[model samples]
Target: MPAGVTTEGCPDSIHQMEVERDDTHSLKRSMSTMQLTMIGVGGTVGTGIFFILSEAVPEAGPGVLVSFLIAAAVAGLTVLCYAELASTIPSSGSSYSYTYATMGELAAFAVGACLILEYGVSAAAVAVGWSEYLNLLLNNLFGIQFPDALSAAPDAGGIINLPAVILVVLCMLLLLRGASESARANAIMVFIKIGVLGVFAAIALTGFNADHFANFAPEGMHGISIAAGSLFFSFIGLDAVATTGDEVKDPKKTIPRALILALGIVTLVYVVVAFAALGAQSAEDFEGQKASLATIVQGVVGSTWPGTLLAVGAVISIFSVTLICMYGQTRILYSMGRDGLVPPVFAKVSPKRSIPLVNTFIVSGAVAILAGLLPLGILADLTSIGTLSAFALVSIGVMVLRRTAPDMHRGFRVPGYPVTPILSVAACIYVISGLHALTLQAFVGWISVALVFYFLWSRKHSELARLQAQAENLTGDQV
Candidate 1:
């Protein structure tokens, strides 16, 4: 029989899964808990808090605060499931790997496609947000701005979003250098983001008016739920910690700690910032505002300097979010490549640099094009739906794994076990149902394409499937 196969069949055991990781070309384990935690924070905190208020507040009024909490709760439950799976089967593919070990190849492929939409398209959406802030910073500080033809997407009345494209390229270059360098840069950016948010909160709170709370839930529960669906986009990066399992030191302990720590920090910052922003201005003002946080600060302080500071901070910090999102996308592709689900070039790591250089280039190029050509609103809705679907699958995978491999050594276990995972799935489904009808249609279309590719191409070339076939053939010969 082939290695990792049993007399009965190809079992989804840890040993069998280990056979998939090629030891000679594996990711370098240089990241610490702090770096991993920072990656999670860096990936998540910027675009959602910095720019999403403009989109979410209009949907829920002042009650967008409840939307933030709802989104965070769903994210928190999924994070618990992620922690358990990452501890039990530490790998680079995040939910894709978890699904594979617990479910099967087809399910893993579907989850991988969802991850592509979540990370790749999300990076594009974030880059667009960064562009908004960059333009604001430039106009405030230098009295100059890119022409709408160069700075906005075609759908948004521009030929292309050049700054967003440029930002993606810069991140790709940094990623090409190595993970350590990328993590260090991300750590610094995360601190800057947190500090800038703090300053905005402090300044904005000074102008808080109790009148803003008079009609808080003006749109009712339906509006709040829809806003929560949009706000869920903000929480997309928490699972990024799980993606670094293969690269972080002592992943079992490191991943769970990073996931929880990152979630706590993000949820607190989001709520505080939401409170400060909403208190400073009426919910109606958030609609169609670019660089909304900075605008809020400007209104509250009645000065250009404070808003300029916020814009500058946004431009810097949102870059970190794009970088980490792109990083996550490339790593997921690398994992898929190793499984023969995509082209082999994606799995090729640079021996000297200890990074997937080609993979980074491919992912960055695609993300840059999307950022430059597509409008941010569509990109964000697509990202939110894809992320929620992937989260739901991961939560289900946790329950499946517990039954299939109950003896697996998990360094961290979900405190509530079955209940927690069940809630995680339900929460994801609830939020997903609140998304726009068009978003749901687009997601279904994307998943259908993925399934087609899996059946026609991936199923034939899949490494795990090939191994199973070999084992079965050998067993038949012996009989």
Candidate 2:
């Protein structure tokens, strides 16, 4: 038949099965570009911008401005590259699906593994950050601490992370009720987060002290690059907008435009917020003031309630982020499982909930433990590395698909074509180059785990193989 059209029941047939497999349970192609833009805006704009400012600024001084610009530039190239691939592929599972259609089931599985880590760690990291702000809101509003033993991660001197666990469970419920909620809720939260940051901006700019910028780049360009590595995590959710291909109308025009719109909006917000925060407080103060956005706000507004309101806004924004990231992680894994990369159960969406229930629970269990155990800096590094790598792959996939399936219907094309994808890869590597050696080791560890899964189970048992074999045998027999 036509390309991307699968002939049923063939081993080694992933190339043929792409369109066929998604025929069932795939979402309706009904999302407007605006809706899709909001989805990306929703996922990418929260936790990192809200909570990461304090964590990142201290490393780069006011030179954190350069760091934000660097991260945004890298993400923009990836978004252009992603825009093309998502339209060509036009399906879910984000990078995992893109890799599958362009590469092979094996490459797809490894990408799936990486995406799982990216989305999963992202969800947990956001959750942990959410918890910090939640605790902050509680402490300021009611003088209640939720018992530090329960609020903190167990290893962090808490018995149970009730807030984190409760939030995960809460997000699970929301996701089960509606996948679309992830996007819509995310849009509203993005505005709130932007608004709060705006208030910070209005005040901080008025009192803007050029003195705080005197030591800009104090840690040197190396420090600013390291800060870029950290800030890159904030850009993670920008691609979630591309995942709406199955539901997006006129994806070629819609996807690319939306990608640009969402990226531009998110970058502007992030950069301005970082600048305002740097002006309001020194970068060195960020690490010590992790959950202190409200504290910084109070410095600007000169009112306890403004800080309280900001904390509440952060809590709301973070909760929504945790929910959306958790949902995205489970769905990516479910897509891989359906292709036979992991256990078939991962592909089995709950008849009751319509979610990939087994995958959700499994991912939830893993991330919960991570949230309860890992330090914030370590988790942020791991997430940034995974996302950068995935973005690079999607960028490269555009070139691969262009050469391999030259006539493929493309709804969107990267403007500069070949050169853009190449530069996208180069830029991702540049930011990744700035990552710490230890973080690189952790990323290597994660990749090794994914490859082990690929060789052990995914390669031979893959659904793609079965379909491919069947197709080849039929073609030979007919001849």
Candidate 3:
């Protein structure tokens, strides 16, 4: 029998059964490497770059540039491991699917719970970010902004973020239409985001000052490490490329190519944008700016028009991020549902649209609630913790799969094998350690709830258990 194949009944064989059942309901494989790369760019280049500098720069000063590079290296290493796993198991669940096939149900469930933060909460974070940019755009264009009472989250002294809720609803509607449509929209948004950022960098660089670099390392090495940890959140969406392995035209080749392509593109953009911003203004100026890029542009251009343009781009780009992140969350849950780890309604695809309609709606609703009620700072930190945990698992899973199933066909293998995986894991741990204690506690609590659900509900209702029972009955009949 093949490595993934089982003789009569085994827990691991459930994936094969699920794959077989998915013939009729599988996602459409219409996306190419270009679209996949764009999706990665779209998913990653959201609020982290747009809003993170205000927080990170205050910690690392101008040396935050190095932090961006360090974070990119960590992201790059993880992307390599992800490419290998994605090719090995061309499923839509991303790390959750990879872990389920290689690890077990409980592990996958825990990872899925963390992924809720990575994708779902990140979507909420991005939506809130979109709302801020929308407010900036409105203020710049018409000299009017949403009253803080309606525009801000309760924690931020507002009742609810109506614009964020509206953005989530809009993305949800776009996603319900279909994957191909969403991918196309994402690609378009990616271009707009890059173009606008390019414009900002160009304009900002023209006013570059040597004075900003004078106090570069004032915060020392510790600050740089802290900034890198925060910047890690910016690189969260690279795995979005791997998650669409099932939706790509050529899983093996396309997934790996797209992963690297996306990583390189995103890293370059981040470095360039960071350099330009630092050069245009002193690091201290970014301390409390809500919309850092817009502020940078406005100062450089000496006008509100350019700032408005950047805000418009951010609004569009972050909307795509929310769309892709929400799409990822639903698919992960859909896979969990198929494995009987969650309710079946989550796995059911809409016949007309061929998308997980119910799951998407559930994710959108949850995301809207989070976006409407929570502040961006906490949401971003929580997203970082979830992403770091899930990414660490992917690194470990690569080494485990390589050792256990050395013969498995891998489309892209990590370059240094054990060393690369070791570094990836270590890097993830280092970054995770820098996360706020509260974020860690919240993550622990969240995972405990998921595990409790697994033991009390999922274990009994698991499809794997049913297969084992059927196999036992067959053996008894033979006896």
Residue 218 of model 2: what lDDT?
81
Q: After superposition, how far is residue 102 of candidate 2 from its true place, in Å?
A: 1.9
Ordering by TM-score: 3, 1, 2
Q: What is the lDDT of residue 248 in candidate 1?
A: 89
Weakest lDDT window of 10 consecutive positions for candidate 1: 1-10
Off by over 4 Å in 1: 1-10, 54-66, 154-158, 209-226, 282-290, 476-479
Per-residue C-alpha lDDT of model 1 across residues 111-197, encoded as one tens digit per residue: 999999999988998899888888878887888988999999998789999999999999998898889899999999999879989
Q: Top model by TM-score, which number?
A: 3
Residues 365-448 of candidate 3 have per-residue lDDT tens digits of 999999999988868767777888888998998887776667666778899988998899999998788667888898898888
> Residue 151 deviation, candidate 3, in Å?
2.4
Better of 1 and 2 by TM-score: 1
Say which candidate scores most in lDDT: 1
Q: Each model's TM-score, in the order given?
A: 0.92, 0.88, 0.92
What C-alpha lDDT does candidate 1 achieve relative to the native structure?
A: 0.87
Q: For model 3, what is the error of residue 40's alpha carbon versus the real structure, in angstroms, after optimal superposition? A: 0.8
Give Cα-based local distance difference scores for all models: 0.87, 0.74, 0.84
lDDT accuracy of residue 198 in candidate 3? 95
